[model samples]
Target: MKFELLKTSNAYAARAGLIQTDHGPVETPVFMPVGTRGTVKALTNEELISASASIILGNTYHLYLRPGMDVIREGGGLHKFMNWHRPILTDSGGYQVFSLAHMRKIEGDVTTFRSHIDGSLHTLSPEKSMEIQRMLGSDIVMVFDECTPYPCDYATAKESLTRTHRWERLSREAFDATDPLWGHTQALFAIVQGSVYEDLRMESAAYLTNLDFDGYAIGGLAVGEPKAIMYELTGKVCQQLPAEKPRYLMGVGKPEDIIHSIARGVDMMDCVLPTRNARNGTLYTRRGKINIKRAEFSKDFSPLDPECPCPACQNHSKAYLHHLYKTGEITGLRLNSLHNITFFLQLVREARQSIQEGRFSKFYENFCQTYPMEEDHSAKNAASRERRRKS
Candidate 1:
């Protein structure tokens, strides 16, 4: 894999580039939808292609636990197993393990954890992570590193950073010792973990860049940190990364967050929000996100978004979608996911165009004004349910 810088905006730190993967060339400032369990939830490969997704992600931990490596290898790798010919990125199972804190025991270089599936015990090390990713045959593979939670103290963050660096080094060595199983090129990208410390971030960045992995991903952010701090840390880390290599922000899904990260020179990203939230009735549009399950849409016969090119907006009405969702029809979820993913891809495409045409600052300003900044549907849903319960 290789990244070719195409252009950079004069106003912001934003840039546009192309990543040459063996599967295909992924335009930079790309949003990779999460297909964590080997599928992108409700949507199929054909639907994902229709929505213009160039790449999707898979989780190492989930795949290893469920289908196991034998199934994937027998199917000739994850691409064939999932029938997704596009570029696939696999995370090193680090974050999943981190989230399983209660069920895991971290010691030295390995973490032993019980499977959320069946409580079966398993261990993961940096070497093992690389081996799993290699077997999965992902176009891009992230290195194994601890993702420290939010509210982490200086001492804890510092210790985690040290462990992460050592693990990353081990990951690189292990990756270098093997070849991709499916006759395709695989790029190993290192994760920079420093929690929220600027000095530790810089230190981690410098250390990883020296090992010279294929690219760099800004990890350990968006883990309950304030939006301002996440943006600040992202900018600082981008400044430390090499200009020629691609810079990815891991697990950042919100539209506003994407805009800010792109302005901060982030090139690639992955998130489960588009699909996961769609399952819960959130449809992201040019105006903003709207909950399809609300009573207001019960008789509303207009399209979800008049200008959206997605199947949900083009071929169906809001009333129909709302009805389907309320009636427990499965198609509703897939359509919503399709629309949200399309909106995200279109947003990134627009940003890339703005950067290439030298109007990124104006684009950013307009996005800030037109797009809804804060919409906590979760809180709204909670309150609405409470009111219904009282009546």
Candidate 2:
């Protein structure tokens, strides 16, 4: 795999590039839909391709739990097992293990935890994560590093940073020691973790950049931190990373955050918001997000977004969607998901074009003004945090 820098915005740090993979070339400033457990919920591979997704993410922990590595390996790796036929980026699953498991215990270089699925004991070291991703034959593999939680004190953050850097070193060594299962280059990206602390963040970046991994990911943010702090730390760390390599911001959220990260020079991102919210009766539009189940939409027959080229918007109406969602029809989940994914993909595509045209700043401003940023998911985030807390 190789990433070629194509263009940059003169007014901001945004850049347009192309990631050349054996499967296909993924244009930079791209959003990879999350396909945890080896499938993007409610969408088929055809729907994914139709929505213009060049790549999707697979969670290492989830795949390791169900179907097992042996199954994927026997099926000739994830591409064939899932029939994605496109680039796949597998996360190390450190975040999942840390956040979703029970009986978590970090023993030196290895973390032992119970499977959130069946309460079976499992151990994941940096080396083991590399093995899982390698067996899956992912085009891009992330280093196994702990995704620290927000509101962590300096002492805890510092300790977690040290452990993360150590784990990254081990991860690099393991990745270098193995061969890609698919006979194609599998780039390994090191993640930066320091919670919300700026100094530790820069220090982590300074250390990881020297290790010279193929790429870098800004991890451990968007885990209930303030939006402003997330952007600030993202900019700070991006400044320390090698500009030529791809910079991925993990688990990042809303459309506003994506636009802001692009301006801060982030080239890749993945989030569950588009798909998850779609299943929950929420739809993204040019103006803002709207709940299809709202009473006001009961009689409204307009397109979800008249300008959207997605099939849902082109063929379905608000009233119809509302009816499906209200009746708990499965078709509503798939259509809404397809439309939301299309919107996100189109958003980044336009952002890339704007950057190439040297008008990203203008595009960002206009988008910020036009889209509503009134997401009050704090309670939801808190619930997620509580779910992941150690028992």
Candidate 3:
């Protein structure tokens, strides 16, 4: 993979770049929709393409546990198996094993845990993670590392960081030993884990950058930390990463969080917020997020978002969407998800344009004023975060 910086905002750390992947070029400041179990929940590949998604995320743990590697390997890797020819990024399954599985034990370099789906025992190591990702034929593979939970002490964080560094080394070696299964180039990106400690964050970034991985992902954030702390740590880490390489912020955030992270120089991010919330009848607009299930929308005839180019907004009214959701029609989920993803992609595209035009600061200011920064959504988001943790 190659990252070419095209432009940088003079007012913020925000930058616009292009990542050359084997599948295609992914524009920086990208939002990857979460496609955890091979599919992105309610949307298909054509729908994803129509929503302008250049890349999507898949979970290593989920795929490995369900269909297993043999099924994907026989299907000729994830791209062919899922019919998604665009760039795909897969996590190392480390987080899922630690967060979702029961009775997990870390012995030296290997982690043993019981499957969340069944009681079957499983083991994962850095080497094994690289091997699985290679078999899956992901365009970008993340190294296996322990994700520190919120409220962890310094000592625990330090120990996890040490193990993570060692695991990262093993991951790099394993990646070097393996080749892509589908005859396309693949890139390995390292994750920097330091919890919320500034010193540890810097140390981790420095150590990983010295290894010269294709990209760097700021992990162990947005796990429940305050928004301010996450942004502070992100800015600190991004400052240390190589300017030429892409900087990804993993498992981060709502629309506001995305805007903040972009200003902190994060090049890539993935989240289930837009999709998951869509299923629950929450819709994002330029003004703010609205719960379409609300009774007030029953008589409202306005479009979801008049300015939105998505079909949901172009063709459907708020009352109709409310009715579909209330009636539990499956089409409601699909249309809502499609609109949310479209809105997110458009937001990122607009941010890129603002950066190139040298008006990101103004754009940010105007967005904050218009969005109103709703607080009631926290309860809904918390439910999603909890599900993510358990997944």
Candidate 4:
């Protein structure tokens, strides 16, 4: 993979670049939709293309648990297995080992845990993670490292950071030993982890920079921490990383969070918020978020977002969506998911344009002022409460 910077914003860390991959070139400052299990929930590859998604994310943990690596290899890797020809980025399954697995046991160079799927025991080492991602044939693979939990004590965080550094070296050696399969070139990215400690974060960054992977990811944040702290850490880490390689922030966040992180120098990100919330009747818009299940929309005949060009907004009405969701129609879920993904992609595209034109700072100020994340919860709660009162 090769990255070329085209432009940088004068006022913020936001910049635009191009990532040249074998499948295609992905424009930097891009948002990759989560497609764990080789599929994005409620959307097809065609739909993802229509939504303007340049790349998608896959999970090593989930795929490794179900169907196994043998199945994926037999089918000629993930692209053929899922029929998605676009570039894909796969996580190292480190987060899953820490978050989902049961009966977890951490020892030297290997972590053993039970599958959340069927309680089957498994062990993942840095070598194993590299092997799984190589078998999956992802365009970009993340290194295996511990994702320190939020609010962890200083000592615990420091110890985890040390473990992560060691694992990173092992992962690099593993990737170097393996040859590529399925005609896809895979790039490995090292992750920086230190919980909320600035000194530790800086140390982690310096270590990874010396190792000099193709890219760097700021991990172990957004795990139930305040937005201010996340942004602060992102800024510090980005400053410490190399200017040439791409910087990705994993499992990050809402629309506002993306904008904030971009301003702080994150070149790429992926999250489940867009599709996950869409399934629950939450939709995003230029004006802000809207709950389609609200009673006020029962008779409303307008589109979900007049400014949106998604199929949901182009062909369906708010009243129709309200009815479909209330009646538990599956089509409602698909349409909502489509719209949400479209909104997110469009937001990133706009940010890139703003950066190129040297107006990112203005764009950031306007977005925060208009959306005001603090007011989002109150609006949604009031809408739901009003519906209950009427019922």
Candidate 5:
């Protein structure tokens, strides 16, 4: 894979670029929909494509556990396996092993953990993680690094940063040991994990920049931090990373979060919020987010978003969606998921355009003013609240 910077905003850190991969070219400042477990939760590949998604993310940990690497390798890698002909980015599985597993031991270069899928014990080292991603045949792969939990003490954060640095060296070595199959060139990105401490964040960034990976990711944020802190930390970290290579903010959130990160110099972001929330009936619109199950939509014969050209918005009505969601029909999840992903993709597309045109600041200001988050709710509770409030 190759990245080229085409334009930059005079007002902020936002810039526009292109990532050329074997599958296709992904325009930068892009929002990649998470297709964890080989599929985007409720949407199909065609729907994702129609939403204008340039790239999609897959989980090394989940895919390895479910379909296993051998099965994917047999089918000629992830593109053929998932039937997605676009660029795919695969995480290093370090985050999942550290965060999702019941028991885990991180020692030296290897992390041993009990599988969240079953009781089987599994061990993953930097080499193993790289090998899994290689077999999966992703266009962009991440290095294995411990995602230090939020609210971690400074001492623990420092220790994990050091370990992450060490593991990064090992991951780079492992990545060098292989060549791409199917004429695909895979780029490796190093993840910087320093929790919320600026000093450690700087230290990690400085260390990794010297190592010269293809890209860098600001990890460990949006885990549980305050929104203000998340934005501040993003600004600090983006200042430290090299400007020439792509900077990705992993597991970042809402439409506003993406805009804020871009203003702070992030070039790429991925989140489960769009698809996951959509499956539960929450939808994003130009005005704001809405719950399709709300009683107010029962007789409202309006599109999900009059401005959106997605199939859901262009063809379906709020009343129809309300009935489908209330009855728990599968079509409700699919249409909502399609619309949410399309909205997110459209948002980043607009951001990229704003940056190229040297108006990112104005674009960002308008976005925040338009789509401000009034509350934080778990998907289920948010749906319930909207339904009750509308009733």
Candidate 6:
């Protein structure tokens, strides 16, 4: 895998680039729709492709748990198993284990956890995470690193950061020991984790960048921290990372946050926000987000967004979507998923264009003025924090 820097905005930290993978080339400043358990919920591979998705994400923990490695191995890795002929990135399941605090106990170098499925006990170490991802055969594999929680005290944050650095170093060695299960090159990216502490975040970034992984990811953010802090730390880390490789910010997606993160120099991001909120009856538009379940749209025969080119808007009316979601029709979920994913893809595409044209500053200002978010936006992210795995 290789990333070519094509352009960078003079007015902002934003950049437009290309990531050449064995499966395909992924345009940078891209948003990957989360396809946990090998499928993006409420949408098929073809539908996702139609939504302008160049790549998608896979959850190592959930897939490792449900179908088991035997199933995926027998099915010929994730691409053949899911029939997605595009580049795929798989997290090392560290974040999933972090989220399983209730069922997991962290020993020095490993975590012993009970499965959320059947309460079956399993052991996961950095080496073991590399093994799991090897079998999954993703195009890009994220290194295992502990994700520190928000509101963490100084002592705990420092301790977690120390442990995370060790884990990532170990992950690097383990990754080197393995070969790609399929014939494709699997690039390993190191994750920088230090909670909300700036000095620690800087330390973590410096440490991981030294490891010289194929790429770098900013983790442990958007987990209830103020949006301001998230963007600030993201910029700080981006400054420390090498400009030659890709930089990915994990589990951050709101439309506004996407552009903000791009302006911070994040090359890629993956989040479940689009599909999850779509399933919950929310639709994103250039104007703003709207809940279709509201009764006022019952007889309002109009597209979800007149400007959207998604099938949901191109063909169906808001009243029909309102009815479908209100009456629990599955089609509602599919169409909503399609439209929301399309909006996100279109957003990044336009952002890339703006960066290349050196108009990203103007583009961002216009976007902020047009997409007026009035609701408590953090509510969705807060709720999503519980279910966070990879995206």
What residue runs in model 6 are displaced by over 4 Å at the alpha carbon?
374-391
**Scored by CA lDDT, what does every candidate get?**
0.92, 0.91, 0.92, 0.92, 0.88, 0.91
Ranking by TM-score: 2, 6, 3, 1, 4, 5
Task: Residues 1-391, candidate 4: write the lDDT tens digits.
Answer: 9999888888788889999999899998999999989999999999999988999999999999988999998999999999988899999999988885346899999999998879888999999999999999999999999997655789999999999999999999999999889887889999999999999999999999999899999999877666778899999999999989999999987999999999999999999999999999999998888899999999999998998899999999999999999999999999999999999999999999998888998998899899748423533554565676569
Score candidate 3 by lDDT: 0.92
Residue 72 lDDT, candidate 1, scale 0-100: 87
TM-score of each: 0.95, 0.96, 0.95, 0.95, 0.94, 0.96
Model 6 agreement with the true structure over 1-391: per-residue lDDT tens digits:
9999999988788999999999999998999999989999989999888888999999999999989999999999999999999999999999999888889999998989999999999988999999999999999999888887765679999999898888888898999987998888999999998898899989988888777889999999987877888889999999999999899999987998888999989999989999999999999998889999999999989888988899999999999999999999999999999999999999999999998888988998898888885444555665576566436
Candidate 5 backbone clash number: 0
Question: Candidate 1: global Cα-lDDT?
Answer: 0.92
Lowest summed-lDDT stretch of 10 residues in model 5?
376-385
Candidate 5 Cα deviation (angstroms), residue 106: 2.0
Worst 10 residues of 1 by lDDT: 375-384
Model 4 has a clash total of 0
In candidate 3, what are the lDDT values of residues 318-383, reduced to their tens digit? 999999999999999999999999999999889988998899999988887777674534346656
How many residue pairs collide in each prediction? 0, 0, 0, 0, 0, 0
For 95-150, candidate 2 gives per-residue lDDT tens digits of 98778634689999999989877889999999999999999999999999998776
Residue 111's lDDT in candidate 2: 94
Off by over 4 Å in 2: 375-391
Higher lDDT: candidate 4 or 6?
Answer: 4
Off by over 4 Å in 1: 375-391
